[model samples]
Target chain A: MFDIHLDFDLLEKCNRCGACYDICPSCLNIDGYDPRAVIKDILNGNAGRWLTSVHIYQCLECHHCLEICYQNYGFENAMTAMRLRAARQGIHPPQVRRGWDMFVKTSRLGEPSLAARKKLGLPEPRESGKEEFLKLLEVYRMRRHGPSPCLRER
Target chain B: MKEFAVFWGCTIQARFPFLEKSVRVVLKGMNLPFRDMDGFTCCPEKSLVNNIDHGLWLLTAARNISLVDKEAVDLVSPCTGCVSNLATAKGEILSNPRKEGEINSLLKEVGREFKGTSRLYHLVPFFHDEVGIQKIKQSIKRDFSGMRFAVHYGCHMMRPSHSLKNDDPLEPKKFDNLIRALGGESVEYSTKLMCCGQGLDRVDQHDRALQMARVKLRELKNTGVDAMALCCPSCFLQFDNNQHLMEKEGERFNVPVLYLTDLMGLAMGYTPQALGLDGHRVDTEPFLKKWKEISSRPSAAAAFSEGMKKEGSFI
Candidate 1:
């Protein structure tokens, strides 16, 4: 099972601090992109409202806020938590779906282009770890689903 | 100087093999102790992998680091995202024995373990710190003395300083120092430290991504920078690839995007074709032509003195 938690203590301070707002690329440039408003809703237990909003995906994960935060927590934590929740409910952006599927299946978002390598006169790519990764994912999914019959046999 | 593996990550290998070529050319020129190791996967690209599954993100990155640990070699990557993700995972697992144990238990079935001993570095810092500017200066066949560059320190290179600790997270100077070492002027601009906002593209926010690229590109263009030099492949995708798309639509901001290695390769006397500079969507010919013209011409100050002497002007 997946458990997600945010530190309200650091976030409480975050709610009062607007320091990173001026620095976060999204907050500064994107219209109506305010993490403080999202934090207020999160602290008030209304984070579900943002599950459908496109704003959560706009954080950029640049860690600008983390550098500026006095507690080093930053609004990125809240944004990441909201994203994880939305993803769990299958409410994520379509690209996230495609990317996750590729990662789960191939263990990489894209494979090295054999044709491109040949054209570039580069050597063949080394073997990927996809098989082992898929095995690990199976074990992980089994653990998450709790005691599958076929898993116990192995 | 310890032997290390190059974590090229998915982007460069998959989409931008030319970037990989440039990095390899420069590293070989410098004779760095870098090797290609098998069994590595994605850095899992934090924004995508971490957002969906934090445990999986941490576990996958730990697994990648475990390979470096197994080889008893440090890891160096040209991709900022890869180094940051692996380092964050290494930091987390090393701090939390219980989590380390859990991940290692899963890894055990695959004959891998997370020892967390190997060091991780992005190429810029590796060159800045390990390679030494003095050596870099001596190695280059030419320098960017008169050329002005706008340096984009991709955010992951030195942010969440608690995890990376590579440079000053807020106002990093290492990239600038490297630029100056190559004899280029690291032009200071208002949005010098701003994020490239490449993440917006991954989440299917194309317009916003363009908006973000527009902000910094406009500033660099207005400041009359010769090129925007950076390290990350994603940022390259945003500025070079996306800027090309914008230009095709008749909105021109002709700022050529240069990988840190591309510049290094050029300075080492590698041809533009050999370094794959031609592969870029945004033409670098203007930047190249201008540099060639300026480097060949006599200095204006010297020219002024020569003219005064010729005219027999004396006070």
Candidate 2:
């Protein structure tokens, strides 16, 4: 039931516009990183190679390209769509899997550290929305349920 | 100063409770009507949650936001990811009636509704726009007159400008404005707008994450700034914790990291211990030491201004 759609119209425009190339943090700092090249591959339907590549993960989702993009369609949208495809195919890095499991289970990446909070003299943390969130997730999954193979575990 | 709920999110309270303390001290010191509310989850950390399940990410963020909507209170957060995620979801839901109805109906199963009315703000913008810089200046007890700071406006704080619209995104000035209002020099550098690249750590590319953090840290090391100031826990983690890791590997990028609130708490005369700054991975002692040395000395410019006032002379 889950699906991601890439806009070739925007992608074509992004391919033509190399303006974001100079502005994307990854394109500038990370060597051999180019989203325009990825966009070209995407247009050519050769994007399967990117799902397993580290370059997909390097986009940083910083939205630098979005802010600087002529079409407001930065490399991040394409990168995010690819990552989602990779994740649905269960191609997540172990840390992402661990993080996803925690989010699904706890409704948060973590609970407040009791010992640390006590030592710091901070107030007891407000109650987490764990139960309600799980219920909400249940409702969400019921409606939008798909073969979410990434976090396949309950 | 409308009452607001502080969405501390997962990171600050869990991995860095001290950052929570710093935020609390500033909130209390400034007498803002911020409260700790119940039943808030992760902002679902857009990169991780959204990548896996876009609907789940939006739903989770909508649920957390609906809590604030239930109370008819505004929402504010210190964490960039939390604010960004919430605002993005709010923007998405508000702009799409179908999505809003769908999410709200789902939320109804859990006894909440998304009115999509509560204003969401990151702390930097909240202080810059809502709290007013004049109030900030008036509250300062010991300003950082001679101190130099590299302000890292974490990306999510202002980007995706369509959603957040918090600043110029490309060339933000609020954090720098806040720093200068507190009497510190906001150091300008070429890599100033560079993302902290903390997202790499979440994907199991710890080495590349370090490589990303190193890019900025290595540059700031020689910029001669006392500390790198930022607002997000993720960026804080990347620069402070990761920098400490690199230091262990003999990379001496001795730049201290400070939260915007941490600097504010200090400038407002809160002690480092009271502000919970000692909990940071990199020691803020050197920055504190230099600040002490710098603020203790009478300001030459202040003296000149005072003498000019006394002389009542105009050239």
Best by TM-score: 1
Q: lDDT of candidate 1 vs native?
A: 0.90
Give every collision pair in model 2.
none
Pairs in clash, predicted candidate 1:
none
lDDT of 2 at A120: 90
Q: Give Cα-based local distance difference scores for all models.
A: 0.90, 0.89
lDDT tens digits, residue span B1-315, model 1: 799999999999999999998998999998888999899988888888889998889878988998999999999999999998988878877877788888888888788899988889999999999889999999988789899999999999987688789999988999999999999999999998898988988999999999999999999889999999999999999999999999999999999999999999998899999899988999999999988988788788889998998899953
* Per-model DockQ: 0.72, 0.73
Off by over 4 Å in 2: A1-3, A146-154, B301-315
Give the local distance difference test score of model 2: 0.89
**Candidate 1 residue-wise lDDT at A88:** 83
> Per-residue CA lDDT of candidate 2, range B90-204, in tens?
8888888887888878888888888878999999999999999999999999999888999999999998889998899898999999999999999999899898888989888
Off by over 4 Å in 1: A147-154, B299-315
What lDDT is reached at residue A82 by model 1? 97
RMSD of each: 2.3, 3.2
Tens-digit per-residue lDDT, A13-81, candidate 1: 999988998888888899999999999999999999999999899999999998898887899999999
The TM-score of predicted model 1 comes to 0.96
Q: Which ten residues in a row have the lowest lDDT in candidate 2 chain A?
A: A145-154
